[model samples]
Target: MSDTEAHPVRISSHPAQLQALEPVLKKVRTRVGDIPALLALAEDIGHAAPKPGEGSTAKLWELLASVTAVDVAAGRALEPHLDAVAILAQAGVEESKPGAWGVFAAEGPGLKLEAKRQADGNVVLNGSKPWCSLASRLDGAVITAYTEDNGRAAFAVNLNDPGVSCETPLWTSRGLREIPSGTVHFDQVPATPVGGAAWYFERPGFAWGGMGVAACWLGGTVAVARDFRTALAKAAENGREPDQIALAHLGEVDRIIASVTAYLAQTAEWIDAGSSADSSNAWSEALRVRATVAAAVERVQTVVTQNLGPAPLAFNEAYGKRMADLSLYVRQHHGMRDDAQLGALALKGDRRW
Candidate 1:
């Protein structure tokens, strides 16, 4: 592709959905460091975005990618909200209130949150849950806790509860500064159970949600690649022809973007076609797609930085932030550990090829 035509390719087959999200994403760009405004914008996106596995899974991922391309921090805040909405729908629970939601399922080495069943059949959560992103800002969240029987279950709880407390000033990451992930403590906080024991992980939507994160990585990388293209285009407009090495870097970027986009599109189609109905298949697909996209994102970053040199990183605010945010965000893929898990699955006859 020529410099002028080297923009990130659209992964969405549905034009209407993209059109609908454009305005909301515009608001997201304006809301940059404003957490409350960004959360509200996430709600707007939730209204327009499709729930995964309802036949437009590819469109859902496309929406995520488009948001990340606009602003990585905004995309970071929006993803879990979208995932929570999908999880609620899958669990057949009608959202009691309309507000931004988050999914807090990450377990830590410290005290595990416990769910105690009350005599009235309600459940109350106690102890601390780590890695609860935007917990202080979001209205509600779907959290996982261990029940009395030592089984795990997903519960929906109101963050506004008097018993809920989030540890602020704890997330010290330079990347995605707007979205601070911290530990949230619950003191007899009442919660409504969403799914049964082990249902959260067993559900196909779990894998789909993980893949949604990969979509964000893809979008952020696309934005980085666009910066490189924009720089080359400017150079060309100034009567400067890019050297053979620069052209070679652009070619590699184009190839990486195309391959990752096609992989995500295919995975999204498979999800909508019920190919991920089996839990093992769903996780396998998610692992492969996430690892593939994460590696592609790293390559694109390397090529862009190598070709553009340190000028952009030192002078361009957007380019620098995109690079930092993507670098941190994609690390959620767990690198070789995920590869090891996939290898273990393959050992169990999970191979498709």
Candidate 2:
């Protein structure tokens, strides 16, 4: 499509979905921005993208739909940046900072960031962080670090500062080529405290953010499913009638897509209703939904790949990229480890789930 002719990606499945996304989509068309237009739309939405005490799940899902529609891999990169901003807002950290600032909180154990309290009570960070997506380009980040007292606390660090350095993004092997996702090293970087130690995981928004990532997974799977839809349509176009097996597989793909859509809606309703008010239960709930949706994504991938055969992967650029991108993205949830943790969370405490 020509620049003047291009329309906002038609990825949303319903009117409410379209309604929630129109504001960002409109701005995306008019403005030239550093991030992708999809992400520019998200940064425009800010805290409005449905979390605790924010917008509804309907709005949040719309953003994910539009994002994945723009590009499956790029949306994963957008998720963390948006999640960091939402978390900071939810925690009231850097509330005064303005503009399209992006953050990546790649702070979950191993190769830690250390926080030292200066004489004036200001905080500085020192350590190496891995999987810091968009670190080289983002305005700032709220990263987890070990404090002088040996506790985990989150410090909001500005990447523009001299003390912070992001390693060259080397994701050529996996898929997400557009995203500069890589490692970051911090050396006495000045920062502001988001909250006291353990605040990052303890906040109710953590689970909410996790579910947002799941929404991205669901959206990307939809993209993959669409490729299958196109293949079937083309088969009909060429007057090559699908045999019984191809027809059956197409039905399976539709069934999986329908199931995932319904689950996403249910999740959206619960999020708007504030079922995630409690951090503990919310974490388990996020895990359950993420795991369930993760399984659904896997099913969709299997159905799409098996039904369409090897031709799409070898010949179709769009389909191949979506497959590779989603294959790598969904692994972020891990295969068995996440499931085991979900089980442990469910059984360990009457309050966990």
lDDT of 1 at 199: 96
lDDT for position 83 in model 1 = 96
CA lDDT, every model vs. true structure? 0.86, 0.70
Give the lDDT of residue 165 in candidate 1: 95
Tens digit of per-residue lDDT, candidate 1, span 1-353: 32212222378574553566566666766887788988888888788679989988887877788778877887898899999999999999977777999999999997699999999988999999998888889999999999999989999999999999999965567688877788999999999989788999999999999999999888888888888888998899999989999999999999888888888888888888888899888998899999999999999999999889999899978778888888888989899999999999999999887
**Candidate 2 per-residue C-alpha lDDT over 276-307 given as tens digits, one digit per residue, 9 for 90 to 100:** 68888778777887887788789888887888
Leading candidate by TM-score: 1
Q: Which stretches of candidate 2 lie over 4 Å from their true place?
A: 1-42, 52-55, 95-103, 107-110, 349-353
Q: Which 10 consecutive positions of candidate 1 have the poorest summed lDDT?
A: 1-10
TM-score of 2: 0.86
